[model samples]
Target: MSSSIEDRLRDAMAARAQAVQDEGPPPPLPLPRRSFLVLHARWTAPIAVAAAIVTLVAGVAVAVRDGVPQRPVAVAPAAALTPPFYVAAIVTDHTVVSKTVTATTSTRAPLGVYDSRTGRRTAELPVLVDSQVAGLGDGRTFFLAGRERKDAPLRFHRITLTPDGKIGGMFALPRRDDLRTETLDALAASPDGLKLAYSVNTRKPGRKGEVRVLDVVAEKVRRWHTDRPGFVDEVTWAGNARTLVFSWQRVEQEIGRETRLLDTSAASRDLLSAKPVTGRTTFFAARPGGSSFLTQEGGGKGIPPLVEFSTTTGQPLRRRIMREWFSPQAFDSSGRVLLGIVRGGGLARLDGERLTLIEMPELPQGERVYLETVW
Candidate 1:
């Protein structure tokens, strides 16, 4: 009976080996030495036969196990996207000469890294004056949009800081001459640090304003223009990366100001192609995947309520915490945490229902608090 089973198994293995030409190659296996087997044929013969059957069975079991598909392992949800550190605003005091007033105004604004929990500054960057700042969700990478004059072309600098907020390195992005002629009202960096969405608000009479997305590494640009005369600013990207949440207001009146959603994947070039999310939003941020929006509505009295609303149904989900003079800046990667300005004071963080006030670096005397900060 054993001899018959061994013969059958050998024949089956030969047939199976022939059928395996479709797969690349079989795994290399050791062959038994014939001389040792012959010397101990009586005792070793039966043992070798049993061992051969066991080896074949084990190989078959292994092949069956590897061939079967496995159910995917369930991954745990990610922790809250609140970053511990932030790249505060670039501090610069500029003087405005108008017909009504001419005075040298100076205010020392916070221009470095700061702790989100304790509200203390962690590190400082060199003076990058007259520049706007944007950040990737990672908390260390940032981009500075700078120009020499109002009409000068804008140059983008990519900055990376160490985990401790110390300067790592800096480099310039590809320069685009076309951006120089237009005014950059808003600039937002994608979470992946590969793309940028900016609004060009040209105050010209008839010409339309523009929204542009630049592929940083590829040096390619995609543009969408406003159909009518309106300004589109405060552009923020949904976690999806392709959806943008921006504030749009007509050039004639600010009454009908609306927060709208733009799908960059759309084929349309007109800015009006964007869908309306909410209206009367003082400042706004969108959650990842464009599923909801958080807006600051009503500020005539005390602190305006930071309300979260469903984008699909346009219904209020819930209201969040707010500090005095809290100006909604941007949302963290998870879209749950918010970073905002606290008037002439320090930074404000809203995580869930809890609001935390972070202290900025002390300003020198005679310096006003003009903060344009980022994470």
Candidate 2:
């Protein structure tokens, strides 16, 4: 390594040691290597140059059930019926999950549920010490996962909403002995909430290349071994419950990646189709609630806009370039509209061919709000 990089590394290590001395050994970082699960919203931020993205969008007034006027989330092509979604913003103080926090802010993660129809913060549900959240279809409840301590096995928890729309209860998901529990590399819940898919951290050499799909109702788990010499990166359920989409990268071979669209209906299971890519190795982040997924182009070099492609065939469908690469967060219940947030820009909605302005909550001075979304 160069002298400058070496110095930077040395300084970072020293700082880390100092932090450990100050705080007790921290919990295993809950790094869901780009969680794209159904209604999955990240409370964490990405490492990138803090480029300010100025979002300017025209608007229209639409009325919701309350008859309240709200700025439109998206302006569809003429007569296009856009799907609606509920925006969930998980506001927190922790910048990095792996590190310890000073515990100055609210102890619980505050979840703000916004009505897309009215563009209003309908309810705020306070959850466990969660850094991310996945929207459950019930429109109120959600899933929370955590690693409370350094050696704490990664586990899933459910956050059920009360009749009044408050965070009524939180419960741990039953633990499985067959699965590795140290890290949660990725997590995806089936649309129907019957199946849960997740992979432990396998980025390390010699770790088995695999992923597990849990049958929530049956309480049984099925394992999918990625082609040997390769590991799974991300997983998502296609529009239908029986189909699954995942990222598989070869570690020992050509050193490239491909998106696997697998159908899990047959006894032996069938690899329906592997989405083909042209230029470079890119992992696909499937948008929740649909067959469409997002992938970065430009060969993993400069930042690339998340491109939307069809799962049946790896064909580009739709995507709106932001001031830069816009992260795809959620899709509407109908899998029609896509909601994305930028590093510095506020929320954006992808309609027919344009990005319409959505609700941007004003943050306290010097405060930043992190958002997660679901339909």
lDDT of 1 by residue, 1-375 (tens): 488886786677556655542333333344447985566466645456556555554444444445662333334434354576777654456677899987775554445777666656767665533455788755777887767676667678888877666778888887564555566778888777788888887757854678888888888889888678888767877666777778787777747577777888889988887887643577776665557767787545777777776655556788755656566777776566788876665677777556677655555443454556678
For model 2, the superposed segments whose C-alpha errors exceed 4 Å read 1-132, 137-139, 147-154, 162-165, 169-181, 203-209, 227-231, 249-257, 266-291, 294-308, 315-325, 343-345, 357-375
Clashes of 1: 5
lDDT of 2: 0.54
* Residue clash pairs of candidate 2: none
RMSD of each: 11.5, 25.8
Model 2 weakest 10-residue run by lDDT: 49-58
Model 2 lDDT per residue over 168-236, tens place: 687777864333333455567676777777754453575545666778777777765633566666677
Estimate TM-scores for all models.
0.65, 0.53
Assess the local accuracy of residue 67 in candidate 1 as a C-alpha lDDT between 0 and 100: 61
Off-target runs (Cα >4 Å) in candidate 1 are 1-82, 90-111, 115-130, 148-152, 175-177, 203-208, 254-256, 311-316, 320-326, 334-336, 342-344, 364-368
